[model samples]
Target: MVAAMVKSARKPARRRLSPAEKARIEEIFHRFLSEEDDPRTELNYDSPYTLVVAVALSAQATDVSVNKATARLFEVAHTPQDMLALGEEGLIPYIASIGLYRTKAKNVIAAAKIIMEQHGGEVPLDRAALQALPGVGRKTASVVLNELRIEPAIAVDTHVFRVSHRLKLAFGKTPDQVEAELMAVVPEPYLVRAHHWLILHGRYTCVARRPKCDQCLIADLCPSRGTGARVPAVPEPERHRR
Candidate 1:
């Protein structure tokens, strides 16, 4: 019983991709670039302040839903001063359609006040400064940075996280670990738009419930193609041609 208990306590070995497999992953991203040259976030914002607020409000909310609210909200409150003027009570009505509008309203108002007083009414581009805001976290900060082109980062939202595990690009249990793994493997040139491509792919194609593997461009290279045997990675020349 003691030996059995000890054996049961041992963790299973993790799968590590080889150089060829890693290159194949890079090639998959290359294919994405070939298809969509300049991928971007779906959220619409006119300025850094609005973008920051939009991303913050987007937590537990859909971009479409957020955009709907922001379309009207931004018309009235595009700047930190404008948002501050709106106040928490005033802001709630604008974002009431969102999941946690009340809490989001409070955070947005507080963050806006901070930006106004501390950052001179501008959204700070730095990650540390952005995360210091009331509602902003690692993922939100990463999104703001990536969208603004202030930095190259992979923000592991549900879409990116699911796609990463589905493609066997990273076997991390958490978003932060998956992000580090991706940054290590993803080639330099493709880093800027990689997150956008992966997010779009997961949202539309590699869906959580039932991925459309048949229509997936990199289906041949995916280890989790839902088939038992591993499919061969498509050659670079052929991949670009498609």
Candidate 2:
């Protein structure tokens, strides 16, 4: 017995950047684009359907962990039909290592059934359709669409949000606001891969605990750049490779 409130909450509109700020933002992405001509998601997937499931499972979980689990999971059930055949019980063991395996397993199973019964086993590319899936949400659908290059979207995960704020690219209190700000401010040409660039920057350079300002390509342009931050003393990549 609950009464609906007459007043509803509304999120503020995306931030508006001044001409100078806009130019700085453009320069920031220019550096990113030059460094990595084409950036892609770290999550491994063979097709759109696999990507949908991978993204769904990645909520509250790391991509590395998801990839490790999916390495074996996808071997047996890459398609919606295959996933349906696996059943929820059979699916649990493969993803048991993930953070919320039990609930994720159920959602995966339910999503599979919906995809098979409603969408003819093909993962729908439409935003509304994708979000309607059991495990799929706004951010997950955005990731799928953006990664596949079917849509230009900035899914404001933790990395993207933190990097956007750190770089002064966005001043948003929530993922939706940050996403809107990015969608509006980012140059159209780089919109598709901006999500990846921000994510990579945050994950490796502008890390949470202690950002490596020295390694950031756009440090000169970053308004939030920490002058006191020191370079991480981690070993160089491929330094000890055979």
Candidate 3:
């Protein structure tokens, strides 16, 4: 009777989803994979060299701007040797409209030189090697790797980070933490495509400032629902793939 009284005195635990609710989350990605015919980077590139330069220039810029710049830029310099020939001055003209074009130009030429001299004009497949390139960071390397399908990696950009937290799929303070949380929870089969799906979703549907929660297919499942709900810690079982 005393034990029963103690149990009664303590507040009941907050409600959480059943296993079926978790399964529903997994199904959401499956639906995304099925819907998106070609889940890949929007940035256009003819070669890995071009992809690297494009991604590097993409910082603080839109894919559209990068594509606009690269269309002419790649035509003239599709390879590292070609890019080096253009030098920073010539590269600037092509990318002048892009944000941070001056710094991007310098890095592009520098990276091109390194690629030509170090990797023999080929973009290194290894993450460390890729990150070693001028202006390349973990996110850029992750994007390159994911696009190549050489590894399953999620590049948590602004959109991805916002969407992940908003959906209560993750509650990380940084991109690395969010990526890890996403990788842990997202099913293995969908790992490769999840990166693109989350990015596109965040870009179009779950946008910043005003998320289209009504249009969001997974809105019902979303804990935050664009209204900043007090999200509970994700359960361990929910963190691992089924």
Candidate 4:
């Protein structure tokens, strides 16, 4: 069929990145580290327990929105014991604004109960332990580990996926593959902070729909320069509101 021929033609055009391209990607990463603050997760949590809860609530939701929801939730329930005592019903109103609230509420309550019973009411630092809990995955575990200063982890969220591929830093088809590629290629010194830097960059500059290429710090290093269609500049008043 004509469609099959076109699909085959498109495949070879997605070039495999070369070694020099990989090195340039590292330079771009260093540039970000030098200019940006020591990056941290946007989710606001006072302790590991609260962090687990916040990340659980953050699925399919924005950190800004999750933080707003959890500000009061954390104030009331900072520990697993506090959360369990609050119970699923009581917790509902606090996290109601987030998506999948009922399911998240149930999982959170179950995980909190397990934390209190099995881990001395503290969030476990190990990846396996964290992943065993409800609503926690590799990405969530990586976020927690990085935030808590655990080393050699790179959590590939939406931002990291987009930015890494566009920059030819990691040509992965899935989040797992991207994480593995980044872990192998990114220097050990940059591993812990890389997630935050890429995330912040993707969120603010190399966005999925409308990349701000003119203002991007690593624009020169990016390989997908013309792939993103040009967008009209926003008026000053509209920009300020955003």
Candidate number achieving the greatest lDDT relative to the actual structure: 2
Candidate scoring better on TM-score of 2 and 4: 2
User: All models: lDDT?
Assistant: 0.79, 0.80, 0.76, 0.76
Q: Between which residue pairs do clashes occur in model 2?
A: none
The stretch of ten residues in a row with the least summed lDDT in candidate 3 is: 233-242
Per-residue lDDT of candidate 3, residues 104-210 (tens digit): 89998899889888988888988889989898987788788777776677887877777788876777776667787777677667777778888889789877667
Q: What is the C-alpha RMSD of each candidate to the true structure, in Å?
A: 11.5, 9.1, 11.6, 10.3
List model 4 lDDT by residue over 1-242, tens digit each.
32332222112213345788657867887898888758888888888888878877887788988999999998888889998999999999999998889999999999998898999988888888998998787777777877777544667777777778877667667766677777666655676678888888888998878798889888888777757843333322212100
* Per-candidate count of clashing residue pairs (backbone under 3 Å): 0, 0, 0, 0
- Ranking of all candidate structures by their lDDT, best first: 2, 1, 3, 4
Q: What is the TM-score of each predicted model, taking all chains together?
A: 0.86, 0.87, 0.84, 0.85
Instruction: Score residue 215 of candidate 1 by CA lDDT.
Output: 95
Off by over 4 Å in 4: 1-19, 229-242
Over 135-242, each residue of candidate 1 has an lDDT whose tens digit, in order, gives 998778878887776677778777787788878777677666678788766766777788899999989998767888999999988888975433233232211000
Error of 3 at 96 (Å): 1.1
Best candidate per TM-score, number? Answer: 2
